[model samples]
Target: MQIQSGFLVFLVFYTLITLVLLHAVYRTSQLIVDEEFHLRQGEHFCRGRFHVWDPKITTFPGLYLISASLLGPFKACSVYALRLTSAIASIVNAYFIFIIRRTVVGKQEDARVLLESISLAILPPLYFFSHLYYTDVLSVTMVLMMIYFSLKEKHNYGALLAFFAIMMRQTNIVWVGYILGWRALDLAMKLCLPNENHQYRLRDLLTTVQTLLGSRFMFVRVIKLIFSSYYGYILNILAFMAFLYWNGSIVVGDKSAHVAAIHLPQIFYFTLFFATFSGSELLTLLPRVLRLVRNRWYITAFGMALFAWIVQQNTIVHPYLLADNRHYTFYVWNRFFGRWWFARYLPVPIYYGIVVSLAFLLFAQHNGRPPLIVSSLVWIVATVASVALQQLIEVRYFILPFLVLRLVQPNVRPSRKLVAFEVAFNLTVNVVTFYIFFTKEFYWSDYREPQRLIW
Candidate 1:
């Protein structure tokens, strides 16, 4: 009865949030930079000229096609129609989060699942994107569904959803790689060494590698593993190549803007974002991390070195930040400490240290379980890889990485205090951000103007 009542309350909460977003459909008349291009792309799609490839286009046609199809009838209300599409996607995303958590933990975690579902729904990042007409919400929803089906061992369905996800956002190729790589690892372990249990640690990988090296006809086994496990990934890659062939290039937007250029600073930024978004999980792990590094003089020495770097570091602005850096996170950080070299830079190194220390601590704590350790490491790798490949910084890029924390950290029911803090923080940010979106009017006379108003 308690579980039923909790789910019932969640439904009411979900419905109320959804209704509020829907109410803003017409009122939020502003369009960010990407939206203008997507709206144009949708117009092109509506006119039957499907192959509207350009040097500045980096994304697939899935989003534009989706918007055009939905807006076909409501031509006059296209903007509202597009926003409505995102609003509906938000609700569906919340449902998937609920179902996935329930599937993972089973019926025993009814209340916890409800809490997590609500958390996912109201997470400041997801909530902010839920109000816009961009592809972030749709791509994230498909990615979550793909992950859910993959966990359920529904490979075919997962692959299909993955294909759609990549279609929505090219960066999602990492997810496809993650899923297929995991399967490959599992298969190689099973075939190469029958006696060993599957685990995700270096020891397991080393064991598999050493066994293959020592075995007769080792090359044949390696080939067999590749052939057996990589068929799905290969198919997706081929599809992506075909998409590029038809579109004239691998990316749809400005190649310079979207290309995979390595930026090391992203490692620091993303780690902090995850640590912050993970909220109390990292907080609760503080003791474990301290204990893990407590006696290591080298760690303490490195900590001091990191501290020095933080104090000396300065804000590194790229073309993106210079245009408009009005995001709440940036705004708040800058307002409080951005002016001071150490104050602004301090958080970056601190976040990096916390994430690295916590990860090593978890590994030491769970040394015997390779599968648990390895699966999480895979997401972290994907998170880093995704950000490293980006040309610019944006909070929305962190959405998938933030979601991947579910796989990284063990599922712990948030304490009442943590829950309250998250609820209050996300609610405040979303309400304020949405208010800006609803009232702010867009004028294309200056590109930087919109950036100052949003974020």
Candidate 2:
């Protein structure tokens, strides 16, 4: 309890500081473009209409449910008040972040890693997402919740959290992979088994081949079970029977080709998955490299893979970079790509420091490195390649790396050399990005605008 109390104290102090900074951004006229986007959808949901037809509101109703239940009619509040829920949710999320790190790094025994990770997460670029209505906050919030309950050495609370997070945002379906692995371990008693109910429906699932095959077959049925992580599988199976489940498409009219145009970016995303997941094939060969290079094998592979993967994903490798947001194009976006880091007080450098440090951490450490390290490396490389995939500098792409942190056995807080490298890399890129955003075609005109005009 004393440890929990200490964590809460530090978390509160950190959140209070973040809130002060974010408030300035909110008060400004130049707030994020998507800041009001979700709130508007909540407003629509509060009006009693299904949100499917509207492109922006097309996501699952979980977020809108909160909007309706908590805030009621969105029009009742001004835009800022409507957005207030997201900012608050962001703060609430930090508590979970701190708790998860404490649970993992502290071994439920220490607080240093918890404190350090919280400190790292609070850095500017990450901190900025908390204030905006962007789904990053909601998505990450759910992801962390999943990590927390799943990692409770004696409790299955983390798995339950994963379900809720997945429901709140479908994109987090990627996390289902982690939870499944955890469940496999739990079922076999291969790892720690919880003493408690661990917070899931404990009822026996009676599945018959006949029932499963009558309507759904093959991977379709397998994925329907996976979808149950978001929607109850039993219920989803029932829904599938009723709706006539089809693999990629059910409707004969078929608009996917056109939808593909709008989502041209996902091509990069899907390819990223291919590159990352398939890279594991090489890990099978790592023993050979390790025999030759020993501990340095980690560094060599990290450098070689990082470079080769980047080259493979770049526009010169493909051609998508020739399109919109061209310079930053491939899969992911770095503030360095568009060169906009410093326009706001948010520290871009700190953000990159976290990324590179994580990349090296997963790549450099081979001691506890096994499936987790391997997966983390795949995630980091592909997601970095995602910068070339997505035209925008969406920091949310780092979700895999963030979640991968949960599986790692704690290390002593990174060494000074490692920490300094991260800090230096982060700050340098941040300053460069700051310079770019401040002077760019977009930010300079807005920079000189009066604070009143900003409102």
Each prediction's whole-model lDDT (CA): 0.67, 0.45
- In model 1, which range of ten residues has the least summed lDDT? 362-371
Report the C-alpha displacement of residue 44, candidate 2, in angstroms. 1.3
Tell me the TM-score of each prediction against the true structure: 0.84, 0.58
lDDT of 1 by residue, 172-285 (tens): 988877777666666766777667655446677778778777886865776676665456565886787787788665576676655566665565666666665566556656
| Error in Å for residue 213 of model 1 | 3.2
Error of 1 at 86 (Å): 1.1
Q: For residues 1-455, could you state the per-residue lDDT of candidate 2 as single tens digits?
A: 77677767877876676566456545654444444457666667665665433454434556766666776653554456556666777777767766666665555434445444544455334455555565666667766666666566422455555555555654444454545543432342211123423322212111222333454554264454444433432332243345335534222232331121122333333333322322222233334444544556665556545544443454222233323231333323334332443321132222222333343444454334323332443444433433333433233554444445433433424444444444344345444543443344333343464222110
- Give stretches of model 2 more than 4 Å off: 1-6, 51-53, 56-58, 73-76, 107-111, 153-160, 185-393, 406-409, 416-455
What 10-residue stretch in candidate 2 is worst by lDDT? 199-208
